[model samples]
Structures are given as C-alpha cells and as structure tokens.
Target: MISLRNVTLRRGTKVLLDAASVTVNPGEKVGLVGRNGAGKSSLFALLAGNLHEDGGEFLLPPSWRLAQVAQDMPETEDSATDFVIAGDSRLMAAEAEVKAAEAAGDGERMAYAYTALHDAGAHDAQARAQALILGLGFKTTELNHPVNSFSGGWRMRLQLARALMCPSDLLLLDEPTNHLDLDALVWLESWLKRYEGTMIVISHDREFLDAVTNVTLHIDVGRLTRYGGNYSTFEETRAQQLELQQAAYDKQQEKIAHLTSFITRFKAKATKAKQAQSRVKALERMEKLAPVLASAEFTFEFKEPANLPNPMLVLGDVDCGYAPAEDAAAGAMPTVIVRKATHTVSAGQRIGILGANGQGKSTLVKTIARTLAPLSGIVTEGKGLSIGYFAQQELDVLRPQDNPLEHMVRLAKEALPEGESGREQDLRTYLGAFNFSGDMVKQAVGTMSGGEKARLVLAMLVWQRPNLLLLDEPTNHLDLATREALSVALNEFEGTVMLVSHDRALLRAVCDEFWLVSRGSLAPFDGDLDDYQQFLLDEAKRVREAIKESQKEARAAAAPVLAPAARKSSSNLKALQRDLGKLEQQMLELQTQKNAMEARLSTLSDPQEIGELGLKMQTIDESLADIEDRWLAISEEIEALSS
Candidate 1:
C-alpha cells in the first residue's frame, strides 16, 4: 500500500499539488489522468522518489521493488533480447553469483548459486525477454538484432518492453501507448490486464485506461481525487457530483439574493428595521455553497469548406510506399508496401485505416496526403478539392523554430486565395480558439509540449477550410476530453474524413467504414474493430508458434549427434506406446481440420474471411505440437530398445 498524506509539491514558483492526499491499496491498477500540465507527471515524479514533497508526508512500503520506463533513448549496440533480459535484476544478480563461485572454485557456493539462479528463472530468461519483445510488436527475427538499429519510436517500445520485463511490485508507466499502433496497443492492454502487480499508468488513451485500470486518480487545482472504478465510471460519477454541486450553489445564491434585497428595501422603514437587521444577521450566519468552476475545456471544429467536391480523390492501382534513395545505384526500384490499391474518397465519407505496425497504414495515408508520391498509377483529384492533412509526427508539418502565428501566416500565404483577407488579428483570434492565446502564440513550437503542439496543428488545419481531412494518429497526444471533442467535431463536419488512429474510442465515434492494409495489398474490412483485435491476437500467436517450429527444426537437424545420449531409455516403452497412440489420433483430427481450412482459404475472396480461416489453421498447427513431441520420444525409445 502507498499513501500521500496532505502532501504539497511545487516546481519553482508553480504549485503542482497542494495538500493532496490519496491512498492506493496493494495490487491496485490506477489510471492517473489530468489535463496537460496538470501535475500528473509531477505526481509520478513524487511516486518515483525523484522529487520530495515540500510539505506533509508520503509513504510506501520500503522493501517493495519498483520499475519504470527510462526516458532517455538507448544508444547501446547490445542485442534487443539481451538488453531486455538485463532488466531482470534478480536474474542478473544470481548469474553474477554463479560466475563468482566458479572463479573461486567453491563447490558449496556454486551449488547455492545454481539454485538461486534456477529460482530466478535463469533458464527461461531469453524466452521471457523475447516474449515481452514480441508482445510489444517486434518481429521474431528482430529479437536478436542490435538495439540501436531500430528507429526512435521502435526504441521507445523496446524501453517499455524492458520495463515490463522487470520483476516489480510497483510499476509506473507514463504515456506508454503514445507510439503504439492499434494492434500493439491492443496487445499491451491484454498484457497489462493480466499483470498482478500494482500499476500506476499515465495515459491519454481512454480505451486503454478503461481496459487496464480498476481505479482512477485525477489531479485538478492542486487536489487529488480518488474514484472507485475505471475512467468511464469516474466520468459518470464526477458528472453527477458536479451537477449536485451546481444545484447547491444555485440555491445558496437565491437565498443570499433575497436576504440582500430585503435588507436594502426595509432597513429605512421603522416597522421593518428590526426584521432587516435580523435578516442581515441570518445572512452572516449562513454557510455559502461556492459556485462550481469547471476546468477550461479546449475544443475547436473544422470550418465549413468553401466547396464540397464529391469523389474528392480517386486512386487507380496506386502503389503506396517509399522511393529509392537518391544516392542509390542505377535501376533502383521503389519500395511498394500496398500494391494496386484503388479507392475513392467521396464527400462526407468517414473511413478508418486499419493495419498492424509496419503494414503500411501510415504509408497509405502519406501517399494520399501527397507527402509521399505513389510508386506507380494515377491519383486524380476532383475539381475544387481541398485537403487538410495531419501528419503523425507534428514536426513533419510544422517548423519547430517558428511560433503558432508564424505557422498560420505561412499557411495564409500559401493556402489562402489572393482576393481573400488574411489579417493577422483574424489569425490570432483563430489561434486563440485552439487555446494558443497571449504569449503562447509567440512560443517556439519546439519548446511547447506535445499536446500544445497538436492543438496548434489542429488550429492551422481548421483555418485551411479543406473539404477532405486526412488525419494520421491525431489523438496520439490529445487528452481524453480533447479526443471526445475531436470526435464530435468530426461527426459534425460536412466533408470527408480519412483517419488512421489507435484511439479506439475516436475510431468508433467518427469512422463509418474501414480499409485494411496487409500482406502487400489493401482491402475493405468487413467487420468492426473487435474483429480486428482478434486478428491481431491471432497474428501474434502465429509469430510465436513459427519461432517455436523453427527451433524444433534446428533441433531435429542436430539429432544425429544426440543418438548415443538418447539411447537406453527403453524402460518406459509401454507408457511411450500408449502416449504415441493417443497423440496420433489427435494429430489425425487436427490434420483433417488443417486440410479443410487450407482448401477453404484458397477459395475465399473476401480478405477478412480469409484472414479468419487462416487463423483457424494456425490453431490446428498449435494443437498438433503434442503429437510431434510424443512421436519423437517414442522413436527414440524404440531405437534404444533395438540397440
């Protein structure tokens, strides 16, 4: 258990928490949420022991193990699996003892060290590390790749995996899903749900919080409030609390008004003078219910486009991906992720882009946004078509050196028509609408926080008054309130929207249909996000099973050398015979199912249906594992008997 008793914390002159107290029970999964810059991270810092409270007392079990994701980007050349395995401090310590015992040539010491190492799971250390890596959305082949080979986003994922690999009683995670794709986010949610340790997570993702958290802790106005349920329940409970507060405030105000009016009118009248004085006394004695001051909400909507272009975009056999490097040798072909993708973006259509990480969801959106050119085929734009594109990386579309006003002025110069008025005051007013008022408009984009930068980008996007909006992970840095607001805005927009996001709530609220990118092709998804989650789980299982099967093949290839060691095990021949017979029957049934599914997969034209059936075949493959292992054992026994 952890407790913060009337704790006060400050950073420089700003007070983050004032007399805030909250108790977190053991094994509780708490979602710490607040608006951007509302001390959620500060509270995390307090819990992590990086900062001390200026006043009051904070307590935690002193012996409890703690783990948190490191913020610094890793620069080491170590293999990814090895790096994650290093996070298991107990295993590392046990291994160190084993080596020290070996160097000292002490048999008793070596025996104790070996026992400790086994207790710490030293044998399956690599398997555990690799499992965490794969669950965080890395390819099986990349498990042993150099850590520094991955990009910054992927490296952050590795850092998260390392943290999760640590054996901890208390875990703290801050914005862990900011870089994850939908598939990876879903995987993480499932993993976290099964975690038995106490977890305090700071995430802007509503669905994730709802799924993983059993408690909610909110920070507002230097106060901490504890709620008994998930994010959705907290929202509902808080709304009702606010309503009751508002009603009390209103009743108090009415009573105060009546008291003041009576005193003013009757104080001069002799007969009512005593009554007025008594009324004044009563007013002074009464307790006041203060008015509810709601937190400032940030919201903005896309301006209606000047013209609606039906069939805003038409792609004919377009291959979406990257082109070869300029310094490449002659005849270098482009890297095409999605082959022959043909689709139309019509007016008022809402389409959600779906895929696993690296499956080209972002590539498809980039091609449509014209940031990346298509490898081949035609992209036709209808007359009066206008596009408002939100790149996944804010810096991709923003000049970090410039401020919000400069960004808007540049957009006015390039996007606004010659005859149209593009006054600075109007731009300032518009920026204010997105909550970038006063000195903030002059603040350099590079110095602003991620959520603030996202707001600035949205402000500029709205100014363009584009009919077609192509948004890529727009909610990655947005808080829950802002995400809901964006959902509403998108719903009200009269133009078309093509969104690529891992925010399930936003997707459910705004998207009308989906397009899935997989295996070098694009197809219309026939089911909902729930089905997509199942597909991702199946995909991950297949990756794990494939790794296992490859290991089995490697072992079989080396079996000849192990023949001598495997002999003389014929004592269990009768038991081995019975096991092999039962395993053979199970294998026969699984093989029949596999053959049927493969045949069905061949005839299926619908992509979603094919994917579902293919996943079934993978399940059959898993069920047949026992038969293979038992058959090998029986063969070894028979050979040993003959020898």
Candidate 2:
C-alpha cells in the first residue's frame, strides 16, 4: 500500500502538488496521467525516493522492492541475456553466496546458499530472461549480442525487459510502450495483466491504459485525483464532472452579476439602502467558483497539393531493402526485406502498415519516401506527385545543430514546389503554426524534446504541401494531446496517408484500411486492428511450434541409440502420462470459461461489469497458462522416459 497525505511537492520554485492526497491499495495497477510537465513523472520520482516531498506525509513500504526502467543509455559489452538476468538482484546475490561458500569449503553454509539459490529460481533465471527478451520482439539470435550493439530505441527495449525481469513489489513504468511495436505492446499488456505487484505506469497510450490499468491517478493544476476503472472510464467520469463544474460556474457568475447590478442601482436610495448594504455583504461573503478550463487543443491541416494524382506512388514488383554501403570492401548484394511488393497508393487513401519488428514496415515506407532505392523493379510516380514523409527517427531528417527556423528555411529551399515563397520570414511564421514561436524558433533542434522534434518534422512536412503523407511511427514520443491533435488532423486531411505506427488509437481513428508487410510481401488485410491482434497471436503460436519441432529433431540427431535396459519403467511413464492428461483437461476447461467471459465482455453495456468480466477472464487465462506449462513439463518427462 502507498499513501500521500496532503503532500506538497516542488521542483525548483514550481509547485507540482499542493495539499494533494492519494491512497493506492496493494495489487492495484494504476495509470498515472496528466499533460506533459504536470508532475506525473515527478510523482514517480517521489515514489522512487529520488525526490523528497516539501510537506505532509509520504508513506510507502520501506521494504518494498521497486522496479523501473533506467532512463540513461546502457553502456556495456555484456550479452543481452546476461544483462537482463542481472536484473534479479536477489538471485545474483544468492548465486554469489553459493560460490563463496564453495570456495571456503563450508558444508553447512554451502547447503544454505544452495537452498537460497533454489528459492530464487536461479536455475531458470536465464530462461525467464530469454522469455522477456522474446516477448519484447527480440529474435533468439540477438540474445547473445552485446547490449551496446543495439540502437538507442532497442536499448530502451532492453531496459524495459530488464525492469520487468526484476523481482519487485512496486513497479513504476514511464512510457513503456514508446519503443514497442504493436506485437510487443500486446504481449506487454498481457504480461502486466498477470502481474501480482502494485504498478503505477505513466503513459500517453489510451488503449494500453484501458487494457492494463484498474485505477487512474490524474495530476492537474497542483492537485491529484483518483478515479476507479480504466482510462476510458476516467475520461468519461472527468467529462461529466467538467460539464457540471462549467454549469455551476456559469450559474454562479449570473448570480454575482445580478447582485452587483442591484447594489449599484439601489446604493444611493434611502428606501433600499439597508437591502443594498446586505447585498454588498452577501457579495463579499460569497465563495467564488473557478471556471472550468479545458486543455488547449492542437489543430493543423496540410495545404492542398498543386495537383492530386490518381495513383500518387506505385511499387511495381519491387524489392525493398538497404543497399550495400559505399565504403564496404566486399560490396555485397543489397539486403532485401520486403520482396515482390507490387502496390499502388492513390490520393485520399488512408492505409495503416502492420508487421512485427524487422519485417520491412519501415523498409516499405522508406522506399516510397525515396530514402532507399528499390533493390529490384521500378517505382513509378504519377505526374505532379508530392510526398510528405515523417520518419520514425526524427534525427534522421533533422539537422541537429540547426534551429527550427533554419530547418524550415532549408526545407523551403529544397522541397518547396515552384511558385511557393522560400523567404526566411515566411518559414518562421510557418514554424509558429507548429507551436515554435518567440525565442523557441531559434533554439537548436538537437536540444528539443522528442515530441517537439516530431512536431517540427510535421511542420516541415506540412510546409512542403505534399498531397501524400508517409508517416512511420509518428506518435512514438508524442503526448496524449499532441497525438490527439495529429489524429484529428490526419482524420480531417484530404490528402492520402500511409502510417506505420504501434498506436492503435491513432490507427483506428485515422486509417480506413490496412496493409500487411509480412513474410517478404505486401498485401491488403481484410479485417481491422482486432483481426491483426489475433493474427499476431496465431503467428506467435506457429513460431513456437516450429521451434519445438526443430528442437525435437536436433535432440534426435544428437542422441545415440540406447539399449532396451536404459528405458524407464512403463508404469512410471504411464503415471506421468496420466498427470499430463488431467492437466490438459483442466486447461481446456479453463480456456473455454475464459472464452465465454470474453464473449460476454463484448455484449456488456455497463463499464463496471465489463471491467469485472475482463478481470475474471484474465484470472482464468492465467490459470490455464499454468496448467498448460504443467502439461508440457509432464509430457516432456513422459517422452524422456519412453525414449
């Protein structure tokens, strides 16, 4: 349990919380939300003991083990698996004790250390770490790679995996999904749903919040408010409260205005002098209500293109991938990622690109953006075609040392169409539309936050007046407000859009169709996001099955033929088989119950009831997963005995 009673938290001279109180019960998954700079992260810092409260009581279990992603870049040469395994400090300590005991030849101490290691599950620590890595979209081959070899975003994913691998009673995650793809995000949601610890996650992802959190803690204007249920419920409840508050404010203003008018008119008259004096007292004694102020809304639109082509871009039997580096001594062949991809993207089409990580979603987008030439086949462009591309890596297109004004000026000179002015003043005003104004326009792009850089990219894109937008993971670092603004703008835009993002909310709101870039091909997906989620699950299962089969074959190839006497007794094998069958039956029953609960969830109209059903289903699924693991272990024993 955690409690903050009338807590006042301040950083420098800015007071984030004044007399704010909140109580979080054990085992609750809380979504901490607020506008950027609203102290959500500050609260996390307080909980993590990195910051201290200015006043009042801040209570947290001193003995609680806390887990959080490291914000600093990981700089190490350790293998990824080893790095993740190090997260379990207890297990590492136990293993170290065992080694020390053995070195001292202390029999009793060695036994005690061995017991501790077993209790910490030291033997399975590597397997657990590997599982976390795989769920985060890492291939098996990458497990042995040095941690520092990964790019910054992949390093962040490694940090996330390491935090999740830790044994903690309290988990604090901030923007955990920023670097994750849809597949990894879905996997993470399922994992968090099964976590038994108290979790406080600060995220801008609405769908993720609704899926994993049971409570919402909103920080606003030096106040903290707790709401029951998920993000959607919180939003709905907050909307109602705001509406009532606005009505009350309006009514109170009218009353105050009428009393003021009455006092002004009758103060000089002897007949109404006493009443006027009373009215003035009433006005002085009345408590004023503050008006409900809505958060600022961000809105921007793409300028209409000079010409809208029927087929803005075409990839005809193309092979999209990275070309060999010019400096490569070998001058090797181009590494193809998406092959035989023939597709036509026309104006006014909204397409969401879907794929697992490393499956060429970005490659396809880059090919269309002309960042990479097709390895094979021709890329045909229509007459008067224009493209507005937003790269996932903002630094890829942005000149770090250049200010927003300079970037805009450069874009105007390089990408602006004929008849468009390339003047510095015009570009500066254009940057202001994206919220860069005053001295901010002169600030270096390298010094800006990711969200600001993303906005700058969008502003540059809009400045070009492209009829087609190719955005890859555009919402990665954006806040909820900025993401909403981008979604609304995309929804209202008349130009064609091709977006590759893990943000399902934005995808659902803006995309009318989806294209899958999987297995080295591009094709239209008939169904929507829900269908894609199911597809990812099925694909994961298939991959697991294939790995199992490959392992089985490898074991067969490695094993030497055994004598008949080497086999285990038939009765023992039969007993193990019987246990496996019972476990399988239990899992099947639980799965059926879970599926029924899911079906009911869809039809239930009440939010509370739906949340209850979802939790119930999650419990059943967890139990089924346990049973499935048991079944697998027993079956493996049975197979070993029979062999």
Candidate 3:
C-alpha cells in the first residue's frame, strides 16, 4: 500500500502538489492522468524518490520492490537479452550463489544454491526475457545484438522491457506506449493484465487506460482526486460533479443578486433602512462560491478540397521499398517490401492500414504519397490529384529551426498556383487557428512540444486543401482533445483518407475499411479489429508450430547416435493429441465469447457498463493466452519425443 497524506510538493517556486492526498491500496492498478505540465511527471518523480514532499507524509512499505522505466538512454555493449535479464536482481544473485557453490566443491552448499536458483526461475529466465523483448517489437535475431546498436526509440523500448523484466511489488510506468506501435501496444496491454501487483501508469491514451487500469488518480489545480473504476468512469463522475458545482454557483449568484437589489432599492427609505442594513450584514456573512473554470478546448476544420479526383491513385504491379544507390561499387539490389501490389485508391475512401511493425504499411504509404518511388511498377495518378502527407517522423517534414509562420509561408509558396500564394497576414491567421498566436507564432519548431509540432503540420495540410490525405500515425503525439478534433475534421473532410494509426479511438472514428500489409502482400481485410486480433493470434500459433516442425526435422537428421526410447511412443502421442484437441476446443469457446463481448463493447455508452465489459474481455484474453501457452508446451513435448 502507498499513502500520500496532505502532500505539498514544489520545485523551486512552482507548486506541483498542494495539500493533495491519495491512498493507493495494494494490488490496485491506477491510471495517473492530467493535462500536459500538470505535475504528472513530477508526481512520478516524487514516487520514484527523486523528490521529497515539502509537507505531509508520503509512505509505502519499506521492503516493497519498486520498478520503474529508466529515463536515461543506456549506452552499453551488453546484449539486449543480457540487459533485460540483469533487471532481475534476485535471479542474478541466485545464479551467482550457484556458481560460487560449484567452484568451492561443497555438495550441500551446491544443493541449497541450486534450489534457490530453481525457485528464482533462473533456468527459464532467458526465455522469459526474450518474450518481453519480442512483445516490445524487437526481432528475435536482434535479441543477442549489442544494446547500443539500437536507435534512440528502440533503446527506449529496451528500457521499458527492462523495467517490465524486474520482479516488483509496485510498478510505475510513464508514457510507456509513446514509443510503441499498435501491435506492441496490444501486447503490452495483455502483459500488464497478467501483472499481479500494484501498478500506476501515466498515459494520454484513454482506451489504453480503460483497458489496463481499474482506478483513476487525477492531478489537477494543485490537488489530487481518486476515483473508482477506469478512466471513463472517472470522466463521467467528474462531469457530473462539475454540473452540480455549476448549479450551486448559479444558485449562490441568484441569492447575492436578490440581496444586493433589495439593499439598493430600499436603503434610502426611512422605514426600510434598518432592513436594508440587515440584508447587507446577511450578504456579507454569506459564503462565496467560485465558478467552475473549464479547460480550454480548440477545434479546427479542414478546408474543402478544390477538386475531387476519382480513382485518385492506381498501383499496378507495384513493388514498394527502397531503391539501391546508383553509385554503389558492389552488387546491390532494390529492397522490396510489398511485392507486386495492385490496387486502386478511390475517391472518398477511408482506409486504415494495418500491419505489425517492420511490415510494408509505411512503405506503401510512402509510395502512395510519392515520397518514395515504386521499385518496378506504374503509379498512375488522376489529373487533379493532390496529396497531404503527415509523416510518422514529424521532423522529416518540418524544419527544426523554422517557426510555424515560416513553415506555413514555405508551404503556401510551394503549393499555391503561380500567382495565388496567400498573403503573410492570412497565413498568420491560419496558424492562429491551430493555437499559434503572438510570440508563439514566431517560436522555433525545435522549442515546441510534440503536440504543437503536430498541430503545425495539420495547419499546413489543411491550408493546402489536398484532395487526398495520407496520414501515418497522426495521433502518436496528439493529446486527447487534438485527437478528437482531428477525428472530427477527418470525418467532415470530403477527401480520400489512408490512415495508419495505433490510436483505436481515432481509427474507429474515421476509418471505414482496413487493408492488411503482411508477408510481402497488400490486400483488403474483410473484417473489423476483433477479427484482426484473432488473425494475429492464429498466425502466431502457426509460426510457432512451423518452428517446432523444423526443429524436429533437424533432430531427426542427427538421430544416428540417439537412443531408441527417446523417440515417441504410440500411447504418448495419442495422449498428447487428445490434450491438444481439448485445449483447442476450449480456446474456440473463449474466442467466441471474446468476439461477442467486443461487439457489445463497441455499442456500449455507459461508463460503468463499459468498464465491466472491458474487465470481462481482459479475463477472456488472459485465459486464451494461458491456453495458448499450454498448447505450445504440450506440442513442444510431443515434437521432441516424436523426433
């Protein structure tokens, strides 16, 4: 359990938390949420013991093991797997004892050390570490690669994996999904559901909070409030509270007006002078109620496209990827990701691109945007085709040293007709619509936050009024309000849209269809998100089974010196097959239930009801995962024996 009673925390002159109190019970999963710069990170720092409260008591079990993602990027030569494994301090200690005992040649000591190692699960630690790394989107082949070989984003993912690897009684994760793709986010959600400990996560993703957290802890206006249930519940409850507060304020204002009016009208009359004085005294004694101050909300709409082009783009026998450098001294071939993709993107189509990381989703998007040329095919565009591309890496399109006004000016100069470039004042007004005003309009892009940069890009896109929008992870850096605004704008826009996003809310709101990019093929997926999830699960199973088969064949090829009993017996094979069949049947039932629950969840509006359904769905997912693990273990045993 953790307790913060009347906690007053400050950094220099700013008060992050003032007289804020919250008690988080053991085993409770809490979602810490607030607007950006509302002291969310400061509270996390306080919990991590990097800061101390200026007043009141902050207490937790002294012996509890706490795990948190490291903020610093590690530069080390250790393999990724080794770095993750090192997070388990207890396991490492146990292994060290085992090695020490063996060196000393003490039989009794060695037996005790081996028991400790087994109890620590040191024997399968590598396998568990590998699973964490894989779930975080690292390739299996990269598991043994040096940690420093990864890019900055991948290194941050490594830090997340290491934090998850540590065995903890309390875990704190801040913006863990910021660096993850849709597939990795899904995997992390499932993994967190299986964590049987107290967890506090700070994230801006509403759907993710609803999925993984049961309690909500909000920091606002230098105070803390705890709400039962998930983020949706908290939101509903807060809205109701605000409504009541507003009503009370209005009632108080009415009384004040009546009293003041009576005093003004009757004060001069001799008979009523005494009553007016009494009224004045009463008014002075009344407690004042402050009006509710709502957070600022902004909305902007995209301008209508100048022309609507039917069959906006056609990809015939398209191979999308990078072309080899013509100046290469050695033999080099073009790296193709999507092979011979033949498709037509029609006008007014709202298509969502779906794929795992490293798949061809981005490659195909780049090809359509004409940022990357097709390797060996024709990419024909309509006569009036115009494109607005929002790249995943924002800096790729934005100049870090340029201000918002400057970027908008550059965009107008390049995109407008020969003599129709908009005036500088109009461009400034347009930038103002995206919340860049006064000095902010002149602020350099390098000094702005991610959300600000995203807004600037969107401002530029909307100003050009392109007929087609190719957005890749547009919601990655957007806050909830901005994401909602973007969804509304996309829904209202008449342009064709091809979106690649991990934000489920935005996807559900804007996308009308989905295209799957996998295994070097691009094709339409005739199903919803639920079906896609099931497909991913089934594909994973098939891949694992294929790997097992390959291993079995390899063992058989080397079986000349093996004993005959090592081979599978008829009875053993029959029993294993029976067990597998039973597990599959159970899994099918769970999958059906899961899909049904998901469908119901989509139609649900009540926060409490949605929370309940989410929990049920999470339970079903955990059960399904457990059954899959069992099936894999049993199949592996059968394969080893049969080989």
Candidate 4:
C-alpha cells in the first residue's frame, strides 16, 4: 500500500500540491491525469523517490520493488533482446553472482548462485523478453537488431519494453503509449491489466486510462483528488460535484450579501448596533465556500478548405513501397509492400487506416503524402487539390535550429497559396492559437517539448488551408482536451481526411470508413475496431501455430536416427505417446479457457473483472507454453525411436 497524507509538494517556489492526500491499496491500477503542467509527472517523481514531499506524511513500503520507464533516451549498441533482458535486475544480479563465484572457484557460492539464477527465471529470461518485444510490434528477426539502429521513437518503445520486462511490486508508466501503434497499444493494455503489481500511469489517452485503470487521480490548481472509478466514471462524478459546489457557493454568497446589506442599513442606530456587531462577528467566523472553477482548456479548429475536389485522388495499380536503390547493382528489384493497390479518396470522406504494425500502413500513407513516389503506377490528383500531411515523423521536417516564427516564414516562402496570410504577424497569431506566443514563438524548436512541437505542426497544417489532410498518429503527443478539440475539428472540417492513429477514441469519432492494409494488399474492412482486435488475436494464434509446426519439422530433421533394431523401445515409445496425449489435452483445455476469457473481456466494462480475466488468460498462456514444450519433447522421443 502507498499513502500520502496532508502532503505538500513543490517545484522551486511554486506549490504543485498543498496538503494533498491520497491512499492506494496493493494491486490497484491508478491513472494519474492532469493538464500539461498540473503535477502528474511531479507526483510520479515523488513515487519514484526523485522528489520528497515538502511537508507531511508520505509512506511507501521500503521492500516493494519499483519499475519505471527511463525518461532519457538510451544509447547502446546491444541487441534489442539483450537490452530488454537486462531490465530484469534480479536476473542480472544473479548472473553476476554466478560469474564471481566461478571466478573465485567457490563451490558453495557457485551452487547458491545457480539456485538464485533459476529462481530469477534465468532459463526463460530470453523468451520473456522476446515475448514483450513481439507483443510491442517488433518482428522476430529484429530481435537481434542493435538498439542504436532504431529511430528515436523506436528507441523510446524499446525503453518501454525494458520497463515492462522488469518484475516489480509497483510499476510507473508515463505516456507508455506515445510511440505505440493500435496493435501494440492493445497488447500493452492487456499486459498491464494482467500485471499483478500496482501500476500508476500518466496518460492523456482517455480510452487507455479507462481500459487499464480502476482508480483515477486528477491534479488541478495545486490540489490532488482521487476518484473510486476509471476516467469516465471520474468525469461523471466530478461533473456532479462541480454542480453541487457551485450551488452551495451561490447560496452562501446570497446569505453573506443579505447580512452585509442589513448591517449597513442599521449599524448607526443604537437599537441595531449590537445586532449589527453580532452579525459582523458571525460573518467573520464563517468559513467561505470556494466557487467551482473549471480547468483551462485549449482548443483550435481547421480553416475551411479553399476548394473541395470531389475525387481527392485516385490510385491506379499503385505499388506503394520503396523504389529500387539508385546505387544498387544492375537489374535490382524494388521492394513492394502493398502491391497493385487501387483506391479513390473523395471529398469529405473520413478514412481510417487500419493494420497491424509492419503491414505497410505507413507506406501507403507516405505514397499519398508524396514523401515516397509510387512505383509503376499513376496517382491522378484532382484539379484543385491541396494536401496537408502530418507524417508519423513530421517533426523531422522541422528545422531544429530555427524557431517557430522562422519555420512559418520558410513555409510561407515555399507555399503561401493565394488568399492565405503570409505576414509575420499573421503567422505569429496563428501560432498563438496553438499556445505558442511571446518568447515561445522565437524560442528554438529543438528546445521545446514533444507536445509543443506537435502543436506547432498542427498550427502549420491549419495554416495551409488544405482540402486534403493526411494525419498519422496525430494524437501521440496531444492531451485529452487537445485530442477532443482535434476530433471536433475533423468532424467539422470541409475536407477529405485520412488518418492512421492508435487512439481508438479519435478513430471512432472521426473515421466513417476503415481501410485495412495486410499481407501485401489493401482492402476495405467492413468492421469496427472491436472486430479488428478479434481479428488480430485470431491472426496471432494462427502465427503461433505455424511457428510451432515449423519448429516440430526442424526438430524432426535435426534428430539423430536410432538403431534399426529398435523394437525393444516400443514400450518406452508408448509411454511417451501417453504423455504427449495428456499434454495435448491440457493445452487444448487451457486454450479453450483463454478463448472464453477473451470473449468475456470484450464485453466486460468493469476494470476489475477485465483485470481478473486478463490474469487468467496470462496463466493459461504460460501453462500452454509449458505443455507445448513437453509435447514437443515427447514427439521427439517417439520420432527418435521410430526413425
């Protein structure tokens, strides 16, 4: 359990929390939420022991192990799998002990080290790390890729994977989904819900908070408030409280005003002087009720498109992928991810791109954005077409050395379409609409936070007055208010929209249709996100089966043939056969249990019930893994005897 009673927390001279109190029991999943500077991360810091309360009681058990994602970007040449495995500090420590024991030739210590290592899950450490890697959307072959080979966003994902790899009593995740795709995000939500430890996560994603957390902790105006339910329930409960508080405050104000008026009218008369004095004393002793003040919200909208083109663009047998390398040897082939894709995007059509990671969703978007030229096909554009593309890595397009003002100036020089303002003051005003004002406009872009940079890009996008908007993962850095604002803007925008986002709320709110990119093809998916999630799970199960089949084949091929006169081993083979059958039956039962739990999970709105289901599913997965291994061992024994 963790408790903060009458706690005062501060950063410099400013108080972030004043006598705040919160209590969390073991195994509770808490969603910590607030505005950008509302002390959510500060609270996380206190939990992580980097900060202490300025006053009052803060209690967390000393024996509880803590795990948190490292904020600093990792720089390492180690393979991704190795990097993730190292996050298991207990395993690392046990391995170190083994190494020292061996070096010193200490038999007793060596025996103890081996026992500790086994207890720390040394045999399955790699498998555990790889499972996390694959769940987070990494391909099997990429497990051996060096950490430094990935981009910054990918590196951050690795960092998240590392944090999840570690076993802990308490886990802290700050914006864990920022770099994740929908598939990865779903996997992570499932993992966190199944986690036996207490978790405190700071995320602006409402759906994520609703899915994983059972408790909501909101910070506002130097106050911390805890709610019993998830974010949605918290919002409902808070709205009712605000209404009640406002009514009470209004009633209190009326009484105070009436008393003051009577005192003013009668204080000079000898008959009423004593009564007025008593009224003044009563007023002085009364506790003033504070009025309900809503938190400040930021919102912006897209300007109406200059012109609406009915058919925004048409792709004819387009090969959406990278072209052949210019410096490659003669007759080199181009790598095509989405082959012979044909589609027509029309005016005011809100299209959502849906696919598992590495399914060429980004490749398709890049082709439309003109970041990558289509290979061997024509992309016919509408006569008055204009596009505002927000790439997954759009920030890379911004010049880090330049300020926001300079970036806008450069954009104006390159693409200041008619009727759009290109004046310096006009650009500054536009930036201000997105919360960049005064010194912020002139400040270096490199020095700003990710959310600020995202806002700057959005401001620039709106400035274009584009009739076609291409947004990929746009809500990654946006807070709830900004995400809602974007959803509203997209809903009202008089333009064609194509979005690829992990944020389910944004997807449901904005997209009227979904296009799926899978297995080197593109097609319309006649289903919602829920159906897609089930599809993903089914697909994953099939993949696992295929892998198991391939491994069985490999083991058979590698096994040494026994003597021709192996009739004596018939009884041994029969025993192995019985064991294999039992293992197979166990696996079938576990898988059945997993499937039923998953079905229940889809329909369950209660976080606690979902969490329970998740835990059951995890146990079933481990049991299946164990059964499969034993099943394979039995099969091998039979094969060796028969071959």
lDDT of 2 by residue, 20-93 (tens): 99999999999998877889889999999999999999999988999999999999999999999998888989
Number of backbone clashes in candidate 3: 0
TM-score head-to-head 2 vs 3, winner: 2
- Quantify all predictions' global Cα lDDT against the true fold: 0.81, 0.81, 0.81, 0.81
- Ten-residue stretch with the least lDDT total in model 3: 285-294
For each of the candidates, the C-alpha root-mean-square deviation to the true structure, in angstroms, is 16.2, 15.8, 16.8, 15.4
Q: How far in Å is the alpha carbon of 440 misplaced in model 4?
A: 2.0
Pairs with backbone N, CA or C atoms under 3 Å apart (clashes), candidate 3: none
Which stretches of candidate 3 lie above 4 Å from their native place? 95-115, 241-297, 327-331, 417-423, 554-643
Residue pairs with clashing backbones, model 1? none
Candidate 2 all-Cα RMSD:
15.8
Model 4 spans with C-alpha error above 4 angstroms: 241-296, 417-421, 561-643
Listed in order, each prediction's TM-score against the native is 0.81, 0.80, 0.77, 0.81
Clashing pairs in 2: none
Task: Put down candidate 4 lDDT per residue, 1-643, tens digits, no spaces.
Answer: 9999999999999899999998999999999987787888989999999999999999999999999999898999999999999999999999999789768766555555665776899879999998899888887779999999998878888999899989899999999999898888888988988999999999978889999999999898888889999987886666556646666456446545755775798689874454455445434322221121122255666787888886889999999888678899998888999989999988767899999988999999999988899986889999899999998888877888999999888888778566664789988898887888899999999988778888899988998899999998898888876776677567556678899999987887777789999999999999998999888888777877886788777754443332222233444777667666777788888888877875766676664555455556546766776666556656776877778
Q: On residues 487-568, what C-alpha lDDT tens digit does candidate 1 reach at each position?
A: 6567556678899999998887677789999988999999999998898889888877888778766655544444333333
